[model samples]
Target: MTQVRFMNWYLKIAIGSAIIGGGMEFFMINTSFYDKVTVLEAEKGAYENSPQSQAMREALNPWRNKDTEATKTP
Candidate 1:
């Protein structure tokens, strides 16, 4: 009788944990967290593809030749 009682308790805990975990995981992944990440990635890609981003990159390049700088004429 004691063995059966322990087995029942174990089975109940296991099944309850599985159900609760499945629900929690479903909510977590379906939240705005994923939406925000996707939006952030899209904005990042758009900025990277913009001409302004390329100009900023060139202006910030350390290895660029001094002759190419806009402050001075050839």
Candidate 2:
């Protein structure tokens, strides 16, 4: 009877530890995901505001405004 009681206690402790460990792992993974997303967002903003982006936009402006220029010419 005492051995059975000890086994029950050990099982409870093991289950409780598993639950706590899973919760901690879930929190860490979510935190890491958000941190990576934030870094990617900042990098995207930097790339969009860079000189190369401006030059590309300028280079493509003629094609983007092609219809407007055609209408004005006639």
Candidate 3:
């Protein structure tokens, strides 16, 4: 009888742990925050690819030490 009670307790614990683990995994898989993150990243990429972005990049190229005088002789 004591063995039966022990087996029942073990079964309950196993089932409970399984439920908790599955719930956390399901929540992670169904979350929507990743969608919003991806959308924002795509928008930023698009803006960086625009003509104004190209011009700004070109203007900043000089400051990036593109001039021959800025090159290290080493």
Best candidate according to lDDT:
2
Total backbone collisions for each predicted model: 0, 0, 0
Name model 1 segments beyond 4 Å from true: 1-27, 62-74
lDDT of each: 0.89, 0.92, 0.86
User: What's the CA error at residue 65 for candidate 2, in Å?
Assistant: 70
| Model 3, residue pairs in steric clash | none
Candidate 3 weakest lDDT stretch, 10 residues: 65-74
TM-score of candidate 3 versus the correct structure, residues matched by position:
0.42
Q: In model 2, where do residues sit more than 4 Å from their true spots?
A: 33-74
Best by TM-score: 1
- Predicted candidate 1 versus true structure: per-residue lDDT over 1-74, tens digit per residue: 99999999999999999999999878878886778889999999999999999889888985576656765875
> How do the predictions measure up, each by TM-score?
0.46, 0.44, 0.42
Q: In candidate 2, list every pair of residues with a backbone clash.
A: none
Model 1 weakest lDDT span, ten residues long: 62-71
Rank by TM-score, highest first: 1, 2, 3
lDDT of 3 by residue, 11-67 (tens): 999999999999987886689756778999999999999999988988878566545
